[model samples]
Target: MRIDVHAHLWTDGYLDLLDSYGRTDTATQRGTGAGATAQELEARFELNDSAAITHQILSISPQVPHFEERAHAVHAAAYANDLYAGVVADHPDRFSAFAALPLPHVDAALTELARALDDLDMAGAAVTTDVLGASLADPAFTSLFEELDRRHAVLYVHPSGHDAGTPLIADHHMRWMVGAPMEDTIAVMHLILAGIPSRYPNVRIINSHLGGALPMLLRRADDQYQWESPQTPDKPSAAARRMWYDTVSHGHLPAIRAAAETYGPDRLLLGTDFPYQNGDLLRRAVTSIHDALPGQDATTVLDRNATALLNKA
Candidate 1:
């Protein structure tokens, strides 16, 4: 019943495609999103061992080349889909896949979504917190959301270093530690506040890195905007707390506890950030969190809830 909802794997063809796009920056080449082969990932996850994970959902790391030109972005997106498909095909038992897509281009993304799901048999698609210069709530993404809703597809969102050309995120250390979380928080805010959750309630969106410090900052965000009149008629409370998050907060116990406390165990999924991080570390972190919680609640967070999310329990 062990199902890790967040993990990444890439293929050589995919790396070649990303390299051809001519838009890779420091962020794409460094950090967690840096591309690695399936064999390397298997070794990292110790998949050859008897203690290897039972199931992993592979996703293309969001740090794929980001291009302002629509045509190049479309090509990169297709390449990503192909790479993810190949990875999952190679290890159908040990892995399942979520497709990568070009966002902010509804037509291209929707077209690829059909191919990825119908042709590749992928579970869903993975998107970044933001698409180029636009947020998740941008009008351009409405059709994309509607299409995913129709398919009842899962949308996995990972943080990216995008910030409207801001120079502050150029510092790699600063960007990943601070900028990435900020990007996640802002992107989730746009989706919730802009009414995407209510409009497309069936679409399941999973945010990585424990919603990127969202559980801790949500109260401040809620309190500050409680009095301000929303542009939309729907109250933000329901949509804000209703989203899902993964437990990949670098094994920080307090952060793990805070996320569970803020969002509750029902919406939390087990995530190891595998290949980039040690799964054993994640297990230890979850164990620590379980030690602090009352009764079987700890066991639920460690595995049961994730099982329910993936329907493998």
Candidate 2:
């Protein structure tokens, strides 16, 4: 089956939930294109048929429910996860979801992870780059990672709207165009430097945006990691290959080809970043991959990789 590992579907209730949390941008964002209403889902299914996608794993990200207040975070996380659980139940064939965690609060997050997986039967968990300004590689998140390792679970890391704490980008209005990928690079590197993948080998970590400069940085790190971070357990390139990446480069064949070359074809999976790339653009996201690589390699990425990963998880 050709499954898209990176897509988002925000229900009106989910949007309303975020609004209650004081998320000011909900009005502009979260258009009907990303909603789960019958009409919107029909539009999404049409795009999927045109793109030849069999299934799409949905997630709530970039606008994740993690908050500063512990109680609020817990309520938000549970609300989002339960809502997505229902979303999956309602569309068993077309949709599955990654549960949202009340992160930066590891204990709460751990509890929610167990509930989401064991009770809600969520496919996995989704989180932003930084856990409300703390690095995921920070020792505080170690227990959560350990539990994920124990479960052999998947963890999808998307950019937090804050852009990984780079004020220059946030203040200068480079939020998505430049800041989003920068956040991806920073978050993944934090894990790489801390030996997250090497240590928690069972956890299948998926980085967004073709790993956000990882393909280009691996060689640089391989060359310098010995002196720069001798404590790192393995070569950055080697440790990086131990993880997975989604092909969501907005139909940019060169970027997709670069990521495939860096991570190998088997590690690449199809990801349309739905609603963001709807209509004709969504169709092109899949076709561009076939154009970027040889037929067999593209087929493996498009059809085989996601099924293998999800099946294992």
Candidate 3:
């Protein structure tokens, strides 16, 4: 029973909202079409079937509403969460969902978070690496993190390609390919440096794209920690191990192996990034991980870990 921990779907209403704001990108547009009809969803399922995927945890891509306008952000978040609830209701066996929240607006976000979890029965919440221009470790989100930790909720950290720095290589859409991971790396570093993991130890954060550059940079972070603050109780690598990572390296075996080695198979979760990268690549990712690990470890990566996370949530 393969369970895909990372997949995305956007309701037509949400897509229309994006279009109205001129925020429709290739991924968002594809998501709009994918959620248009039952046939479209079935096509997605057919691809999952080929990959031996029995279930998926659906989430919205990082096209979260800008927090400048509180009303728009709040409405969009509620709408998206409600729409996702309907989708999950229609296909309870095939899919589950992580709700989207309006960040940078603590009160509104808290309200929606409660509604999505308590009322809508969502699996968890999907948040961007940064809220507006603020880091996830920002003090403004203290209550938010505290609440999530108290509830033992799964926090899916998706990337927005925001603040990836000046692009040196623009050819072949390098910004997205390179920038997205960089954003995730920065976000993780901020969380670690700010002591978020230690403060909110119970909040389960699943970093996307195999935790971006974290697997490779963890040793460097630890070295810096030792040199700068040896008295610190939590080392960088130790703090990183507390979080989870998804297997969505876009078919990269080395990334998967590195994450598994660093975080262990128990911390690894199977992810497809479906409707954005497609199911064929997801199948390839699954195959690659299976090839890299022992049978039981691969099984744990593919399903057991996600099941455990879901059950805990």
Candidate 4:
């Protein structure tokens, strides 16, 4: 079976849920529409006639940073969890959900994290690369990471293009084109160099967009930090090299092949940034990976590997 581990869905009544948070810009306004719920996503699937896509995991867009204040952030996370729970409940067979957490608010995020996992029965939680410019490896957020590691939480790393110097919006077309991947690369780098893998070994991070320029810079990141100077500890940076990436490169055959060659098959997962890009494009991208690899390697890349990562097995 085909399992698309990376997909998003937003409910029509999401506005009502967000009404209390005050009027704020959403992912929809940004043209990515990463905030759409499962109901909206289902409709899109039908409209696109993508009936072949059977099992999918639904998550929210991490691009929209809502936790400016601690109170607002907690409320926003609670509401998102409630809404996503309802989405999974309504369509248990068709979709599973990842809980959205408010970062930088460790205590509040910890409480909501437990609630989402224990009470809401979510697969895991989605996290931005950083919280208000602070990297995920910051001490303020270490408890949440520790808890997630203990609970065996899958931390989906969705970069928010939040860097101030090169604001994604400043570049106009470069926002998602260049900015998204750059932000993701920075986030992953921080997680790796800060020794997150060593600290939280159980935390499974899903790096979106084929690990966001990581494949291209694998040699640079690994090579430069091999000895680990003042920037990194005295250790090889193989942990960063060993990460889970998705196949949402938009039908780029060479990129997909190169990623598999660099990261290997087991590290690759099935991802289709559906409801943002065309579903057909996702299908083609996945198929390209399968075609590139031979025998069980292709099978593992297409579905087996994703199932193991998402714990759908």
Winning candidate number (TM-score): 2
**Local accuracy of candidate 4 as per-residue lDDT tens digits, 140-194:** 8888878988988888877665542374455565666677777777787777787
| Tens digit of per-residue lDDT, candidate 2, span 219-297 | 9999999998999988899989999999989988889989999999999989988878888888888999999999999
**Model 2 regions lying over 4 Å from their true place:** none
Q: Candidate 1 on 177-196: residue-level lDDT in tens?
A: 77777777777777877878
Model 3 lDDT tens row, 1-313? 5778788776666867866765646353554345738788888888888888889988876777655678878888888888888888989888888988887788888899999999999988888888766788888999999999999998999887664644463344666688788888888888888888888988989888888999999888888986775645688888888898888888877788888888888988998887666756657877888887889999988868888888832
- For model 3, how many clashes? 0
User: Any idea what lDDT model 1 has?
Assistant: 0.70
Error of 4 at 270 (Å): 0.7
Model 2 residue 274 CA deviation (Å) reads 0.8
* Models, CA RMSD each: 3.0, 1.4, 2.3, 3.0
Candidate 4 segments exceeding 4 Å error: 12-24, 27-51, 63-65, 163-169, 226-231, 234-237
Candidates' C-alpha lDDT: 0.70, 0.88, 0.81, 0.71
Q: In candidate 4, which residue pairs get closer than 3 Å at backbone N, Cα or C atoms, i.e. clash? A: 9-36, 9-37, 9-38, 10-36, 10-37, 11-37
Could you tell me the lDDT of residue 221 within candidate 1? 65
Cα TM-score per model: 0.86, 0.97, 0.93, 0.87
> Hey, what RMSD does candidate 2 come out at?
1.4
For each predicted model, how many residue pairs clash, with residues at least 3 apart or on different chains? 0, 0, 0, 6
Error of 1 at 294 (Å): 4.6
On lDDT, the stronger of 2 and 3 is 2
Clashing residue pairs in candidate 1, if any? none
Clashing pairs in 2: none
